[model samples]
Target: MELIQEVMIMYCTRNVTEDLVWVGGNDRRLSLFEGVYKVPYGVSYNSYLLLDEKTVLLDTVDKAVGGIFFENIEHTLNGRPLDYLIVNHMEPDHCAMIEDLTRRHPETVIVTNAKVAGMIKQFFNFDIDSKLKLVSEGDELSTGKHNLTFIMAPMVHWPEVMVTYDKTDRIPFSADAFGCFGAINGALFADEVDFYRDYFDEARRYYTNIVGKYGAQVQALLKKASAVEISMICPLHGFVWRRDFADYIAAYDKWSRYEPEKQGVVIAYGSIYGNTENAAEILACRLNELGIRTKMFDVSVVPASEIVAATFEYSHVVFASATYNGGIFVKMEDLLHDLAAHNFQNRTVALIENGTWAAMTAKQTAELLGKCKNLNILEQKVTIKSSVKQAQNEDIDALAKTIAGTF
Candidate 1:
């Protein structure tokens, strides 16, 4: 007699929508707050297993976690062989395990768009065309009960990116459009997890860090998504959204639009000495007194990723920096560059410069911000004179008033 592990039957994968499924991937906890870069709260190499008589596996996990992904697929299939493997994005993390999966199931046919086929050959060196079913943007794959419709999502974080929607189930399995790091423990669906406690911030972090540069393209993608009558969003990673899924979609739209979230102030300051720091603190307190919510971020200490993430949360941004060699501080420069690359739109930005002799951070930051369309800069700038003085305190207060009034 052969020993067997406990069998797992899945109605649908945890993080996926209806006919689409989220089979595996996502780390827990680390993606919550900030600490390090390169290694995000761990990452989930999400894959989906779509079962409807003739089974299809959408994407594969990273090679490092291939074994786990196989386990999830096997558990879902219950010994049923995979008939098709759809390649949505060819990023190594999502496609690394494809070779392994194909080796196990030689009969599986690979389906993908033309550009993705080239990527597969470049990375895997396999002649996929012979066994590949090339599909277009509106191609459909029927699996008895579900009809999977493919939509092209160019520059939606990647050039070869695409999404699959199941009309029968009213679910969309977006490749990475709404993905986030951090696992939702055992909870499978979006409604099962605590959105306020877990999913909200991480989703913003993922968007800002990974796909911030493609804000305009995202707006177009959202318009495309609107055409579909979707009730659930099963992204590649994180939990599946089954109930009130529109809320998540709306949130993504707002962030990508670079619209402000309520009336609040974000003070991101980078100070070599304590002078700029003092200015930021004063600004925070002054804003508080005006009955406005204020959040402070030390650019030197805060990860650029977190600062990017926070941009999606607040309406107004107050950038305070000490001048370094007649320019913005290095950290502040990096933050501004990242923000500008994302086409920071709709938000109001205020500047605070601290320099003993040449006050350059304010001018430089303003010039950099000018490149971003629709970014409103406060006319009144708070200049800290090397040291915190009584006069500087008044300037900070006035700056706070401008931010509050803009709201």
Candidate 2:
């Protein structure tokens, strides 16, 4: 059977290869992904169906697109019974349709690891014990032409996670290792779209905010991947990587190592009456004037997650906050804590604090940043009394030059 050749991002069925078809769907109506990150462009729940001597479904989509997903399966299978249902990761977005899919294809055998088998019992009430086919690291499953080898990838954000390698097509069915946060509305492959322009920010945000803390685990996974000869990467979300994807993989290497992709500055500040913001703006202007790339955000307006992601992108971060009752401003405090929680490390930091009487946010914010690892705080801190004073303006100039010189 031939598949549709039209390229679109809607809930449409398409072919991934001669033996495989994409039976996934996108949700534009979804406002916030996981009730946290704002998805103005929405996100995708990807699933693939393989048709060989015995048919196999790689994974299931989020429950939001259950109707479209099942429709795609019915259309792709064309009445052929599903022989195997592979569970790459047990995350809710990728595993929500398991029970329903099994019920529709009652004879489909689930191929997963031992950990995911226990998770199945917790997520659904079906008789998984009878239909479960457990695999371990380096375990291979033959579906006529394609041989899938499973690699254990525990704590790559989840305890029960793994990725599959197809020997026939040289493709890796990565669970969430290379995925992003945006929907696939046009091109399915990263090489087909302007990936760096459209999806790069979301990809950084997805990794830094969602999977940032698991650098060691991701590093371990990358080491395992190096052992195989991969021609393409089909992750559970975002676009597939067929060609010109070395940069993305290299980025994962850097990100997993908690290394910056670029040497620049990202300034995030909290202000009560705009005094701290004023200080931040001055620093940003001076830094850019000195030929240091700068990105500025106000904690009161921009999302903390975005700021956290920015911190991951650049080598330097400037934390400026107006002192509130002898403490760091509420929003700045939260933003700093968020960065620390995401396992932020190996970056230089500069401080700027504004207070009418007792300027203490520079010290307080430093205390919070101290919770992170390998941070280099600059000795040249800037303090403002309610606003940027005449002498304090000179202090800002010195601090900006020191930050710019680090590059």
Candidate 3:
């Protein structure tokens, strides 16, 4: 008889602490996140494994990467049984593997709040009465050397969302609060990567599109967070934060407050042909000439998520659209509606409309923006009939001057 050799391949895992291991995987093949936003760089589903007197698992990966995630968890455990599964957020991406995990680790007790306990039953049809360890705000649980505290952060994009604080390690398992979109390649911590250059835009896009509407809720959460002493942040997605925690917290504070991060202009245009685009281009040129930092995007081409992120980053916004069917162009209309839905406010806005017949884009745009909060809609509405000729130059220049003057 010939003996056959078997090769066992272990999944990728990273150490977050002496005992805590990152048992998560990246979805590089995914084209979209949440079946909506485009994720070209892919997204990470982060789960943590803590080996202690009582082993605990922090969150779980999405079902798409369930096999690899399990492999990572098993490898990190090294045959040790999981004692507790700490669920920080009940979103499907982070909780989809809960049933599989429970089936495998039959003795594991789920530690979460009442709201999440109900959600688990609703999502997985599992009986939450038997193995659930319910926690509340400021509730503490000890797993040998580590003491974990739960903090309720309702409507931080989800009503059942909560963060876990490790008192022994001074680490906060912040759920999706500080998460970004990009996959963690070799670098697992924020200090390991060029975050501002590589991941900042995606982070902003992620927050603005996913959690922008709940600014007040985020503010409340931030207020609670300020009272805690957080040394490291372990979010459910993207890289972990072991250093420069203040900068990330400040960024979140500004975002939750609807305050622009920088002084600049974002000119987004929806043009049927080239007329409206031409007007936008001309205005962009004027702004640039006047020493104002400007960014231009064709609303028809760019995704609304990116535009929303840009609107959040910049202090000023310019909307130029061609009137279509007696209204603003559909692409621009969609962007405006998204901005409003995200609770966009506290910015200076300039309107430009182009039409061959009835020019209703400017009026419709103004009305839509009027519904938002603290928006300074410029009174100098530039109307372009068919195209921008030399006659519209003075109006364009005036609008540009007004926008530049605000800077």
- The models' CA-based lDDT, in order, is 0.80, 0.90, 0.91
Tens digits of lDDT, candidate 3, 232-271: 9999999999988788789888998999999989999999
After TM-score superposition, the amount by which residue 400's alpha carbon in candidate 2 deviates from its true location, in angstroms, is: 1.2
Worst 10 residues of 1 by lDDT: 29-38
- Steric clash pairs (candidate 2): 9-185
TM-scores of all candidate predictions against the true structure: 0.91, 0.96, 0.98
TM-score rank, highest first?
A: 3, 2, 1
Off by over 4 Å in 1: 1-22, 27-41
The numbered model that scores best in TM-score is 3
TM-score for candidate 3, residues paired by index: 0.98
* Tens-digit lDDT string for candidate 2 (1-407): 98879853334687888888889888889988888888888888889999999999999989998899988888888789999999999989999999999899999999999999999999999999999999999999999998989999999889999998898899999998898988898678887788899889999999998889999999999999998898889999889887888889999999999999888999998989888888899999999899889999988989887998898899999999888988998988888888888999999999998989999988888878788899999988999998888898999999998987777
Worst 10 residues of 3 by lDDT: 121-130
Q: Give the TM-score of candidate 1.
A: 0.91
In model 3, the runs with Cα more than 4 Å from the true position are 1-9
Error of 3 at 199 (Å): 1.1
Against the true structure, whose lDDT is highest?
3
